[model samples]
Target: MSKAVIEFTDFSFTYRAQQEPTLRGINLSIREGEKVLIVGPSGSGKSTLAHCINGLIPFYYPGETAGSLRIMGQEQQEQSIAALSQTVGTVLQDPDGQFVGLTVGEDIAFVLENAAVPLQEMKERVTAAARAAGIGDLLSASPQELSGGQKQKTMLAGVLAGNVDILLFDEPLASLDPFTGTRTIEHIDRLQRETGKTVIIIEHRLEEVLHRPVDRIIIMNDGVIACDLPPAELLSSGLLAGTGLREPLYLTALRYAGVAVTPDLQPQHPELIRLEGAAQRLEQWVDGYREQSGPAEAVPLLELKEVTFGYERETAVLDKLSLTVNRGEMLAIAGRNGAGKSTVSKLICGFYKPSSGSIWLNGRDIGRDTIKERAERIGFVMQNPNHMLSKTLLYDEVAFGLKLRDVPEELIRERVHGVLRICGLHAFREWPISALSYGQKKRVTIASILVLEPEIIILDEPTAGQDYRHYNEMMEFLRGLSSRGITVIMITHDMHLMLEYAQRAIVLADGKKAGDDRPERILTDRSIVEKANLRETSLYTLALRAGLQQPEELVRTFIAFDREVRRR
Candidate 1:
């Protein structure tokens, strides 16, 4: 057996700013060359454990510590971050924030250059690492010009160039499209096998990470280790759901069908899981299930006619695209990165005017409307909360929009508090923005928009950093808003979110409308799914594996059933 590369004994940590320890008594060990996944709900100490391993706890965070943490058999506190980087290479959650060079090659070489490696050696290492990361062709490309997947590869290459023994990825799939996320997992698995390195991933996307094999999964909750077991064992434990984390969708389907999920059945991977009576059980479930009716005929509320837009004149980000959003409709815009998903929201919010198209809002051309004028009817919650957040306190942030519109102070307080409570932020209303976690900040941004109560709300990647419990709460709130005649438009990469909440899905590929239909139809169609860089939901796969005649209908039925269960 390989020796332990990382070990913690009675470990605990408390940030200097906090009275309580973020992590408590974490006694764990990760062997050399092990591939481990750490997952939990938000504020579950998963990030704190990761920071401890990567030397961020003491070196950067300045936390009070207890007990021992050893990386590569060396005491963690004795080593500086620079020294730790030589053994543990960390790829942060946001790749854009990590970029320090103009081109991919230069960025990858930055680490080696910092260590004062020879120029020729640095160049060779950078090229080799880029090739290994499958981004050799993107060496000359600027980080801004690459797709999300490509940018992730660039970040991987930068870490690879460091030649570290352990690679730590922090929420690597958070911003990626479904297809890209699957590919990234494949790459990580391949890198681990080829390099014989220890791989540690901190992520909430458990099912996505389980796309490839992992040796074990470590579940953290409330500042301590909750469960540690192999993937198959963990899946069979029925602990994930109880801990407020989502189990794999296929497993959920299996349980719904009354199938016993056991470790012996190999339940970790959807394709390989053994299901003895799944076909019959699922068939009976489908027979008993009633499908929900489609949305009522939509009265067009917004329209884009031959919208052609580009940052530069020569290349259009959105090319001659056209679509309509119905009033009070819950619409989802989905595509791979760089397919102009966010750009569409920006255009509607009047951030950028279409180069040659008319934007019609309620039968009137709003191309001449200023951004402030658009804000009266349109509320946009951006993907990055940092970009939209300006207030220091949560309450102040949520109330900022209402204050600007000269709403009465008392009414603003009432509205802001209500929205904050709806968004699960009422408890943290007095907290500073910097003190909150990323997921909390996301809610703050959403609350800021919700307080305005605009006619139409546009949320970009609304649930990216959120856990399952909070995601459900937020989506339920949005569903209530939709029921009350507020139009909701979501630009998201979460396949589950798209299937569950979106009434209609608009798929764009190469900046063109590839498909427009119900979410289940868009997801079940192989061509559209691939073209839009999406994965068919595991529920769809489960249906096919169960030998169902109409897999698409099964997908739809499952979603309806799931929604009903959540509603209850």
Candidate 2:
């Protein structure tokens, strides 16, 4: 008999905030030692369901839940969250949000101390957890000092210290870079293998998470248990798309080639060959990217020539690096955490001056320019939206930049309203910044800059923490800007986002340039993928693994060509 680690029997829940229940008649059974992937779209009750399992339902969130839930053979109601801690451990979205200790070591030791474990034993436990999370060197470092990926690992260390049998991972890889994300996945896998723990991963980055060897894939939609199947079965099903989930890019690609259930099950190599040829055709058919001379036509609206800079002249974050962003270009900068993508933006904004190399603006060196001087021309948006909102109200926040520039009040109002509409924040322009969702706050940041009418915009991971809908809206807005001759430079870890939004990609590895090319070309290059510690996109990998000839083409019904075919 299989041990049911987490069993939800016709469970239902209603939040105090909403008239309708968030979770309706949910029935799920996760067996011991099984690796399960919970896939869902935004607002799909995934977080709610996860909270319920880990004892956050009645304890933290106000709600009425019916039916029986068993965690570690104990009814969920029978055990307190503290008691349940012995059975299940949870790692949340923002690892930094969960930090309680000042140092990483202290953080990992927290649960042990909470459980009243002896000092000597707690020390051993903390050491093991830190080792497992791959942050042994960061023990004394403050959790505040860690990168997004490092913070997540530190949180995992905290959870691992509890020595629980079931682990709950909620969007663990969302903020992680390709290398760190994969490493985290590997650690999770190894931890499960060694300890025989049941791991439940709730993630929206399905393609990456599901690519692993999971026992089953459980899908949630509209607060309902839509499907429970093996990973292969879920991969082969079109239900993900049908349920309004953004299916993995690979699955989307295969579907494009007209490969339905059968072709997916037993991939057709000949069709893949055709698909590859088709991909090449798409590249060749890129009529819009006509050959331009020098780096000038390559000449971006913003140019950095041999730029190098540092804070106080010790260690340069950027080592004399040079880059260019053409007018109307969407350029993506990718690298592991702390690889200077953000610093590059700061350099362009003149927040820090180059020690040696010159930065060119419209072919003129602006290396010694002030941030204010650069700001008049370029807009730099940081990752954290809250930090950027200067005013209390959305309308005021959007208009803040232009107001600082001393634009006429009438013009500021007019342009702010226009940009709010374009950025999809018009309805909430009068609302307080405190009332804004993370996605909404992010859009407000973009609008704040857009109203300034900067010729070049640099966004640092614009799509971070966003759902597919928000992601699409943000990218679509950026696309419109690019069309109007604004050069969009994004520092991001999302390979798919780069592939779709950016016309060109520049990869920085080990603090230097590894690639500068179209995303299609960059992604197809194995050397680049290897150097960056990125796994192939699921569709690309599936096509490769399944021995397809034109894997990329057959993957999407080949969207671009299909659209062309439709138009023809």
Candidate 3:
């Protein structure tokens, strides 16, 4: 008795300039009130399919299409974009880009104003929506002044005010920390359940989106629907890896321990996935596992002494924080949102001068150094790839840094080409930057910095919106940099990245150094993990559930096993 909210019949679309169809014969139906998660590798047409439903493909992108696409049982070609907006509400990846008003309440009201709604009713709707999204108190706050999570809530309130029955979230968790992401997903799930709305979430973080109960999981690959089934069936099909999507960490751990996962196993909920004989098998495996890391040989590459800074003098984002980065170290700055992780990177890059602190670069004070001078030694890649891309062509974008440094044309070309190959962007050398996807644009930014050959590289959420293939390529490239004596620091909220890539993790809580040690040691300390709002990996949870003698060994073993498996 489920009503079909969206229906696609032999739907295929190709851009005006391209010959290949982005979506090839997509025949899918999403029922009303169904919660679905759509996932795929980058360039796999997930986003394209989302655009089609929201009326962005034909209206905004100007694509050549064939076959029938319907929203609310109405053919897409018959309805205008503005008309379709009433039925479909989209919360985009970048909340800032969607904002049109100065204050949170005003932003929520702006959409209502466009629809010619009365002033009194608009006010009532905005308040109700804000309260629903749990941002009622932030109504008076400026949209620009709100935190990332708050901004997203503001957008959600705006969407809810539209009173749309079909909600589409595009990478909602990409820019959020673990705690905020979890809460946001839960809130969205509640909205869906309470309203009987059709919700379709397009995200790369499969496991995080699985926090809520998903009715179905749709896997896409190369413009085709690879698999569409219930969550348990999709996880048990063993088709995720082949489709270039990441399986849950707990499932990976179980497989590593030689446990056969059945449909009865809840892969998404690690704590709930109890196999009859799996605990004994995992315990035995952990008992035989040993740590491979040795004691750190300290050699300071960069040092921060008593740093203190804040946008407002009343509150310090970073207060008297001291840290050291050793040579050839791959370190992670781990903390909750607003815990000064990005602030630390900015201070190190000389973007902001510390109010009271000294930054030493190779035994020399860098406090007085200009940003340009600091840039010669330290390279920083921003979290948003669009902010970093300036040139139209991929080659030009990658060679921009070298050009700025007055590197000879010949050398710039050679270095750009070399870095492009390393970052997996060589094939797109002549392509327009606008034509490339978000993941490809991120690689261009990294290549642009890598060509500079800096002694230290700092990346702010480098893999935020990337798929498994691009994420692995970028991480593997960064790993290679660490092996060549470069000091690399990653400011991230991704627990998987912290546990797997970061050799050492520096935990920050309330602008103070909480823990600085091996990632395993830092993560295993439940106090520090909670203080920083970091998620405990399923591997750790599995170890505890199985009553393993050394839970730390499970962490070590999972890291080793994951790396080896990725190597293949």
Q: What's the TM-score of each model vs. the native?
A: 0.98, 0.84, 0.97
Q: Tell me the spans in candidate 1 whose CA falls farther than 4 Å from its real position.
A: 292-294
Candidates by TM-score, descending order: 1, 3, 2
lDDT by residue (1-568, candidate 3, tens digit) is 9989899999999998788999999999999999999999988999999999999989999989999998998999899999899899999988988999988998999879999999999999999999999999999999988877898899889989999989999999878888888889999999998989999999999988888889999999999999998988888888899987888888888888899987887766776786679989888777776655564587899999999999889999999999999998999998888899999999999999998989998999988899999998899999899999888889998888888879999999999988888787888899999988777788888889989989999999988878887788878988888888898999998888898889899999999999999888888889998898887777788888888888878988888767766778
Backbone clashes in model 3: 0
Per-residue error at 517 for model 3, in Å?
1.6
Please list the residue runs of candidate 2 whose C-alpha ends up more than 4 Å from where it truly belongs after superposition. 63-70, 73-79, 144-147, 263-299, 389-444, 447-453, 539-568
Which has the higher TM-score value, candidate number 1 or candidate number 3? 1
Winning model by TM-score: 1
Q: Count the backbone clashes (under 3 Å) in each candidate.
A: 0, 17, 0
- Number of the candidate with higher TM-score, 2 or 3: 3
TM-score of 1: 0.98
- Colliding pairs, model 3: none
Question: How well is each residue in 490-562 modelled by candidate 1, as lDDT tens digits?
Answer: 9999998999999999999998999999999999999999898999999898888889999888888878889
lDDT of 2 by residue, 141-218 (tens): 999878888898888888889988889998888777877787788888888898888999987777667445788878
Q: Top model by lDDT, which number?
A: 1
Residue 53: error of model 3 in Å? 0.8
